[model samples]
Target: MSDLVWTRGVEWLAAAASDPRACKRDWDRGEGIALLEAGRFWDVLSVPDQLGLLTLDLLWRPTLPVPGPTLVDTAAHRVGFFLPPDPDSKWIGAGLRHAGEGSWVAVPPPYRSTRFLEWLIPPDGTGELHSPTTLELALRQANGSLSVLAPLCGG
Candidate 1:
């Protein structure tokens, strides 16, 4: 990404924090990640790393792609996908967690990936987010595939 585009994306990501300045200061101080509150600008839906990876592939394979900012916590074995905030949306599935309306999420700088925490798909500063319905469907498909493959993989 160009410097200007990345700068805009970083700015957009930082705006999610209550104190955007503090987050920027921490980043400037070499902190790898900052905790940003959810529900203000957007919400996060997180799932197990394996399922998330599968969902991501499914999401991107469509003719009309569902692109969104995505984060992966390797150490935690989870992945977070950014979505537009909706108080009424209650996501349900095993290993699925929603960070919305008062929850907080650890966010990495948009420009690059850090140790343990990285962005699978970085924000583009356009404020675009994944469609909740599309993501839900993809997650279901991914979960089904995993269930079928688990026995074969001996997991």
Candidate 2:
């Protein structure tokens, strides 16, 4: 949107989990990397997926390796990672910014004791900054060989 500095054409992204345990829960159910941010509670920006429209979760950079097809946002200081659709899902390379209330809810990075939170430029009240990382490097880190930081999930 005009408000935020985000990159378009990013193939995919990953965000910090609202509940780390939930990520494990969904993954445990065979749902690879699904998040509550990707569910109906948030006004998700969606693209076409194998199932239909895969609701994309918000992230600036990735703290954890999101093993799937993905794109990166160079701005926002890579403060988080955007969760992508499934690896095989074909993204349309397009999305719409949510404008109405209760749409595009806060999808923060995993909480930490040391790091401080930052907002999207042109600040919108959202979640805390977890591990801010660019999406492209994150993909490489996820799939390729790169030492990276692990995602946090508060206990």
Candidate 3:
């Protein structure tokens, strides 16, 4: 049952790839990650891992929002959260990057967790994604908190 869910989830993510067949082929060949185009299925909000994790903590507090797919790239020291695409969307934060129209993001298969690039929150094959507004709020709060503490930590 779990295998089927993961398989479906991978299929759901592969649709974002420029070439779904090639993406599947790379996964079959045991490649660690594949680059998938954004804007077709979803957009990505990327930030430094520390701030991203803090934002996640804030997002989970009080009550959980509908969970969305998230990626962590330890090698790049970045974390990416998937959100429904909005062509004109602009995100503002100290370390935030918006990958919306005409952007590509490296993604590991939903069932795979590579050492560097892996899923922090895997898709459930339901095509659900994070709310951009909610994510922005959490990111804003986290960024503010981190910035306020940076000097204290001498960072």
Candidate 4:
């Protein structure tokens, strides 16, 4: 991906961190590596009904033509919204697929959308999320509420 695109995504992530309504959730740091190794892009999604954070795994070929350098051909992206293991609850998995070109349609919950937002920063405030550049790029890709352009432009 181009540096600018990556930077934008990082800014968005930082801005999302500032969102009061955005819930703080924990995710595996290794998941990012795993997704890249598996040729997929994974994102974190926090749903109101769920108690903890959820992961949306986009299982795509990454070989098709995309608009930007960061864009990749999406063979099939799946959203696996799961609730972390708890004393009273087991891991639940839901599958969402891409429908109608750029839309990701959940099979179980029945939600449809071309784009969904996921938290790039973990709740712990450690790992890759700490980098200002990383945060900017994530937020740019998210087109999130942070309005991170100012920081990204060195404002």
Which residue pairs does candidate 1 place in steric collision?
Answer: none
The clash count for each model shown is 0, 17, 0, 20
Could you give candidate 2's per-residue lDDT for residues 44-143 as a string of tens digits?
A: 2222221111111332326443222222222222222233223232323323222122223332222111122222221122321122233333333432
Judged by whole-model lDDT over C-alpha atoms, candidate 2 comes out at 0.28
* RMSD each, Å: 1.2, 16.4, 1.7, 18.9
Residues forming the 10-long window of minimal summed lDDT in candidate 3 = 58-67
Q: On a 0 to 100 scale, what is the lDDT of residue 120 in model 4? A: 25
lDDT of 4 by residue, 1-155 (tens): 35554444433323333231221121112121111110012232222221111111111126421111111112233222221112322223232221222223221101111233232221221112112233223323433322355478674
lDDT for each of the candidates? Answer: 0.89, 0.28, 0.86, 0.24
Q: Which model is ahead, 3 or 4, in terms of TM-score? A: 3
1 versus 2: better lDDT goes to:
1
TM-score of each model, in listed order: 0.95, 0.21, 0.91, 0.20
State in Å the error of residue 123, model 1.
Answer: 0.8
Best by lDDT: 1
Q: Alpha-carbon error at 105 in model 2, in Å?
A: 9.3
Ranking by TM-score: 1, 3, 2, 4
Segments of candidate 2 deviating more than 4 angstroms: 1-15, 38-155
